[model samples]
Target: MSLAVAGEEHEESGGRLKAIIFGGLDGILTSFAIIAGAHGANLGPVPMLALGISNVLADALSMGAGEFLSSRSYNSYVLKEREREMWELKNHPEGEIAEMVQLFVARGMSRVDAEVVIERMAKYEEFFVDIMMKEELSLPVPSEEDTLESLKDGIAMFLAFALFGMLPLACYILAGMLAPSLDVTSLFSVACVATAISLFALGAFKARFHDKRYLYAGVETVLLGGACAAVSYFVGRAVSQFAGFEQLEFVIQYEQQPTVL
Candidate 1:
């Protein structure tokens, strides 16, 4: 690929990575919270599944939509600024050229050399404006295909949230469907371990992207997930007790119900 194509691809990859990290982190934490809280309250498998699935879908959509709108708004702002720069260049060519020369001088070029460079650049209006946009406004022009790229980012976020967020509830879901006679507590315990592992793996992936220490990043993410789970679980338990919810019996009765012919 040409340099420009390579750069665009790199930027696109970076955007996707950001969306994945954001969506995955949110998905894991939110799903884990729901599972931990429900388990602490001694809720039944049906109710836990309902909460987990609902949260995964609803929150994933919200995050994706939010990202799309935010990206569009940023692009709009950048375009507006570029328009302003274009206007200034048209109405004040001499001043703009002088500004470019001063910018080059500020960067350690001799004044005469700066003038010569600016004069040559000024021969090409588009190139001159680009240089001014970068040096004067400190704004790099975005890729022309950013709209499609933004859409890709949103889709990536939604997929990541849906897939990774299901980790904490996956074990329970599988057990309920595949082995109804299995111990509920054991299933939940397995789900907790899976969630921890997922969080660590996500952090390691993030660290790899940012060139950080993978082990430390993994540990940090795991600790964060554990802390969130602990808080949600304890708070749920406390509330259930205070309200006399009696969720344990309800769950037991639900599990014990006979299948109707």
Candidate 2:
């Protein structure tokens, strides 16, 4: 029986889930950091919205491109190793067969059965290559239509990042549009709550694929994100104070004397 067949479905789903979790986590954390820092610096809604939107788009694109390149690199390396294995199989059949027999023996198959199994597998070149890729190279065989699949994974990451990453700024932007009279502190408080809920939900979603309890995972993720935001907030606060930036704001009033013009 081919071991790959048994786990192929599981691996595919797991890979996609991982991409979503990774992208979501990154998006929420980064945007929250920017929001926290802006709040600490006592910035207005316009600046916060500008910073948050800029980070979201730039970071999502960078992450998607990075994922695509990384997947492509891994695919290339696997192809090269597969080529090497095929060459060795053709030029040194005895050595390759011995390695296969050893692998089976180590799995508790008797030497006689191991040799018999390898001999039968060798009769089919495709099956022999599959075994060598799995056992010798310790790599899953690449899917035949993987290029499009990789692209989809990258797009998934970008979309997840953009959606989840906007949470920290969502409340601020909405409040600015809906209620200009709202205090900065009130707006920031709402943003904090939204970010916390998002962090917890993402953690729980990720935990479904692992052995950890969902509540524990949720709390852990929230704590991590909170800690990062807290650090960023304090740093921004300290920098702003040291630079005396708070005193730099100016409100200009035009006097009726301007009619002299």
Candidate 3:
């Protein structure tokens, strides 16, 4: 079956769902990695805190800007195409109606049904305009309100990531100070607990949007978070051992090179 039936509009809902999934998962995953690395290398609170703060701030601003630009560009393109559609309608109303008829006919409507629908729609220029915009173009133009909402979604993603991402680092920092004698393994255990809880909750939140079962979602998120954390931890350990440096300066400094992505 098709994703949507006729007279159904799921674009907005689907868009919102995707935003939540990607934003929450990315935040949990990326932050988990950083915290795992910091803890693995036995870096002091200073570098760990710096990395957490930088990752959150930089990612949030970047995501917000990216959303604003993409939404604005898409909106502009839709509006331009709309104007083009309007021009075509004005220049050749008959042709536009015929095309709409063909579109309806191709969708299982009989010729008579298609013509009747077209005739009824033509009576209201606005209705015809909407048909062409929605059905033919398949481009949903965002209103000013929609543009603001899109930006807000991006900001929400950033904040969500920041909050979840910092949990592991925060737990490590707090635990390390309170128990200075705690070993690296102990610290990692605590951080993992924090990571698991945060990722599970975020995954559940994401699942709510999809109307899916939470158990699977939670497990998926937890695994992804753990994976990211493990990779960073191993990489950090290798760097520290090979370089014979107690600090993570090399890894962080090397990351400063222009990201190829």
Candidate 4:
């Protein structure tokens, strides 16, 4: 591939990576909060695990669909802009040529030199097309391969959420299963600490893209996770209270449900 093609591919890769980071972090933090809150409110391990996994699935699917739509929207805008440029080049060749010459002059070329270059380039249709695309239009036509690659990127982003999001919730749930002796609150505390550290690390990594302070990103991520956990815990308590006697009976029935030998 030419340098231009290679550059465009690289940019698409960067965009996909960005999507993965944002979606993955969102899943991780959101699930962390829900699981932590459920645990804190003394919800049974089964219910807590079910809720966390369900949220992970729902959030991942939502993010993946959103990414696909956003990519399509961006591509549509670029295509429309390119079509507009093509029309301008077709209907007003002289005006487009003059615009190109002026652009070159603005970039430090002498007026006479810029005009001469434009004249020579206009003699070659391909050269003129390239100049208009690079300077006047500034819209690159993405190849078929690029479009497929972008879809792949969207899928990758979706999967990232699934993988990263399950980490904390899985840690807590599995810990409870493997060691029923340990209290859920204690298990949740461990999960929260682990989740906070992981999110802080991710936030720091994200700073490479946005040039934000590393400490601020780390603190923000950790705080967000904590806030989510707190809210979920209270919500679970409220739900349990509202459900009252029916909920207690349901919990008993759920617990008494026979396990297959």
Candidate 5:
């Protein structure tokens, strides 16, 4: 495989790109909110990192599983509709062909030409069913193994979420290890900068989906996502203040009292 998969396979694989971009976007925003909120809560590094890491894993799993189940449901619907089409072709050939003819004619195809076209198409049962599905039902006929394709999409979503979601947390881990003296506010600033850049780039990447200027898309993404994260931070701050949670400004040490259920 070429190292430039996105460039080389731009037209060939939209589904994978969609999973990667959207998943990455969701991951970044989600991680940013958790960190921002945790920071707002005045939690120590241990508690913040703990919250961020655990939430990332749990949410990533949910997103991945949700994507897989949705894809499976969609594939099941298409396959079931396909089987129904095949049955109609088998038992009600004339009616199905008539429907195809009407669709073609409604699109300004000459009646005689439409009849001739469908007549030839009807001779091939497989081709006939494919056309019927496309013209009559407006659904893509599944060509590959349905289960495998859905699984691939699901796995793509999972890996994307995990990889991208961990980015915000990675900043905290690296800073704690390398710059042990860095304060939480400064550390969070670094994370904010990194996340803003990532979100802008991802938004620009989305230019392929809609024919829009990359700058506009990038700004839109940053503004929208930043707004949401900001809300999370303020909410966390308000909740912490209202509840009078202890403020831990420690850099390394964390005190925890174990609870028994």
Candidate 6:
């Protein structure tokens, strides 16, 4: 049989997977933290639902927009650097070649051999600049489609955050709308369960993009999320107790509710 590849297959799609994993993790933790805090402060499900939904929407938009801007800025910077490299290569060929020679020698190549390779590579200007970018700057070659890539990244992050992050709040909203008579402790317990499941599942999903085993990743994520949850609950309880605050009104007002929390 033909030899199997000795290395893992390259995946351009890994960027999207990265965004989803990170965004989902963020969503799950934030939503759960909010739930835990609300529970500690004795906030009702209706308010929890409102707060959770708001967090998801606002954070998702922020993530998407931030990703787009960051990606675009990176692309622009790379292009500028490449242009500078090209200019130097055109005007100051000796310095660029000398720099390349030094890099090769630093990496354990003989001076003569490094000079030979650089001479051959320098004959092709585009290839020459690409080598300099990689060796000298540790950068990938910039692409014309960078804008589209940014849009994709932003959309991926937004969707991942919005969809996965909504899990904890989703239970509260559903329970409030459909089973209004459910006690607060019972509802919070259900929310905790949902949050735990969401964190574990998202971790498992992340393992598909990495070398980590699914079960290990899942458990690690749960522990991390549990830590965050504990902190959030403690903060809420401390804030309420220190401020001498009473329990919020339990009414689920539909009309004329205050717009701000």
Model 2 residue runs over 4 Å out of place are 1-15, 245-261
Q: Any residue pairs clashing in model 5, and if so which? A: none
Candidate 5: worst 10 consecutive residues by lDDT? 245-254
TM-score of each: 0.82, 0.85, 0.79, 0.71, 0.83, 0.86
lDDT of 4 by residue, 1-261 (tens): 656544333333355667778877888977887776676567787787788899899989888888777877777777677677667778887998899899999999999999999988888765577567767767656556766766876787789888889989778867777888887678877787778888888788677657668899888877877777778778878776777878888999999999989
Q: What is the C-alpha RMSD of each candidate to the true structure, in Å?
A: 7.7, 6.4, 9.2, 8.2, 8.1, 7.1
27-48: candidate 1 lDDT, tens digit per residue: 9989989988988888887898
| Every candidate's lDDT | 0.86, 0.85, 0.77, 0.78, 0.85, 0.86
Clashing pairs in 1: none
Which is the leading candidate under TM-score?
A: 6
Locate the minimum summed-lDDT window of 10 residues in model 2. 248-257
Sort all candidates by lDDT, best to worst: 6, 1, 2, 5, 4, 3
Rank ordering of all candidates by TM-score, starting from the highest: 6, 2, 5, 1, 3, 4
**Candidate 4 Cα outliers beyond 4 Å, as residue runs:** 1-16, 37-43, 123-134, 204-220, 227-261
Candidate 3: tens digits of C-alpha lDDT, residues 69-168? 7877888888888888888888899999999999999999999999998989887876677679999889765577987777777776666656666677
Residue range 1-261, candidate 6, lDDT tens digits: 898878866866676887788888888888888888888877777787789889988999898889899989988888789999999999999999999999999999999999999999999999999889989998888677879988998999999999988888887667766887878887888888888888888888788778769999988999999999999999988887755533333343433486876
Q: For model 3, which pairs clash?
A: none
Expressed as tens digits, the lDDT of each residue in 1-261 for candidate 5 is 667545444566565888888788888888899999989978887888888888888888888888889988887798899999999889999998899999999999999999999999999998889888888888978766867877887788888888888988897688778888899998998888888888898889887667768999999999988998999999999999876744453322354545569
- Candidate with better lDDT, 1 vs 3: 1
lDDT of 4: 0.78
In the range 1-261, model 2's lDDT, one tens digit per residue, is: 656655344534566886788999999989989988988987887888899999998999999888877887888888788888888888998999999999999989999999999999998876798789998779867775787778888998998899999877886688767988888888888888888899999899888888758999999999999999999899988988866744443212333235664
